[model samples]
Target: MANPTFWVAVALFIFIGLLYYYGVPGNVGKQLDSRGKRIADELAEAKRLREDAEKLLKEFEAKRAAAEREAAEIVSNAKEEAERLASEAQEKMADFVKRRTASAEAKIAQAEAQASAEVRAAAVDAAIKASESVLRQEITGNAASSLVSQGLNDVRAKLQ
Candidate 1:
């Protein structure tokens, strides 16, 4: 009963009993539970945010695909238009060339006809002069003049 160790042990037991009576363990347990609940809520919020991000990613991907398709369609239409225009231009050029060639040929034919007429007129004039000179040399006086005139008249009528 007089030992110092025995008195120290008794004091420790009394301190433990006071703490229990005041509900300190219960308060610690409540705080731990609240902390755990807070951690769970934060985890749940993080998962929801991740799900929203994935949804947004999928939506953006879909939009990108649609835009690509539209762009391809535009390019295809442009190519077709360019080809059509090229063909039309070629056709127009061919038509123009044909028309020009035909016009040139017609002009050449007209020039040839005019040249032929001029040459024939010149030859007739030369033949008439030669005949007149020969007839004057071969024939004599009044009878010769009358015969020459008649022959000249006949040649002029026939040639014209």
Candidate 2:
């Protein structure tokens, strides 16, 4: 009635009042709260996933360390076994050499005894031949035969 501008301002205020009276502000607040809650839930899920990943990494590290320790133990056992086998082989070789050396020495001693016995037999045969020759040169037939018998008896008694 007085100014049209004043009427437009009043109509704008009435429109704002109607929006507030119909619960639009409360609906907007509820939507904002739901969005915040959803964001918080997603953040919590992300934290749980990160923690699970860390736990898996630690487990893998522990398994790797155990595997390395087991491998080292296996290598050590193999080395000890190899060393024992080598030591046993050395001992066996030494024993075999000692036995062979003893056997060789016994064989050498037996050969020496056989040679000594043959030499003694040859010397006895030669002495008998020389004694017979001397006896034949000094005596004739019947006297030589009688002296030969007595010398043979004396030689046999002395040898026994």
Candidate 3:
């Protein structure tokens, strides 16, 4: 009954009972409930932010895919256009070559005709000169004397 430990325990019991009678425990329970609700709200907000970030990433991915598709189409169209232009150029070049060949052939034919005409005229002149030279060689001294005597007899008859 005289121990100091016994007195301290009795004082602690009195303090605990007074605290319960005044509804202090109920106040502590209310504070704890409010703290738990705040923590739950913060966790829910964090989940919502994470979901928004995932949606944004998906949207960016879709945009990137569309851009890649568009680029492929443009490249395909460019290649097709280049091929068409090359084909058109080839046809035009072939036509130009054909026209040039025909023109050259026509020129060669005309030149050949002109050269043949010139050769034929030169052959005719050479033949005429050869015939004149042959005739001079055949008429000799006897043919010259007979022409002179015939002319003198004709003059004497006219005088008689």
Candidate 4:
């Protein structure tokens, strides 16, 4: 009210003088340097931690890849073993079938030979009966005597 401009100027001068006396370039530079160093250290620590994390990730990836490859190899080996077993089983079955067929064929041939021998024996018996009947009807005494003598000689030769 009385001289407002004068009081205003005095207050401005006091404020500036305090800044000059106590502020290191106004002390702000020293304060900011300390804070900046703290911030830089924090950034470096964060960078180190990030690098460690990246290395761990790479190791895990490599391990995972190796495990997958091992699993694939195991599967391949199992498949091959199964196939080999199947092939061996098939071969054994084929051999068994062949042996069975041969045995059946041999049995059939033996049966045929036995049947043929029986048939020959039956025919010979029938022929002997017929011959005996004819001889009984036609033989006279002298002729029968001559036949009997020849039969005795043949029997003796067969015995020798």
Question: TM-score for every candidate vs. truth?
Answer: 0.67, 0.61, 0.56, 0.61
TM-score of model 3 (CA atoms): 0.56
lDDT of 3 by residue, 62-160 (tens): 999999999999999999999999999999999999999999998899888888767765654454446445544655577745654464455434532
Off by over 4 Å in 2: 1-43, 139-160
Deviating ranges (above 4 Å) for candidate 1:
1-31, 135-160
lDDT tens digits by residue: candidate 2, 1-160: 6899999999999998998999888889999999999999999999999999999999999999999999999999999999999999999999999999999999999999988878876777678778878878878799788989799678856753
Report the poorest 10 consecutive residues by lDDT, candidate 2.
151-160
Taking all chains together, the TM-score of candidate 2 against the true structure is: 0.61
Top TM-score: which candidate number? 1
**Number of the predicted model whose lDDT against the real structure is largest:** 1
Which stretches of model 3 miss by more than 4 angstroms? Answer: 1-35, 124-160
Two-way lDDT contest, 1 vs 3, winner: 1
Error of 1 at 82 (Å): 1.3
Per-residue lDDT of 60-145 in model 4, one digit per residue for the tens?
Answer: 99999999999999999999999999999999999999999999999999999888877866665565556655765677687785
The TM-score that candidate 4 achieves is 0.61
Please list the residue runs of candidate 4 whose C-alpha ends up more than 4 Å from where it truly belongs after superposition.
1-6, 12-38, 135-160
Look at candidate 4 and tell me the lDDT of residue 101: 97
lDDT of 4 at 30: 79
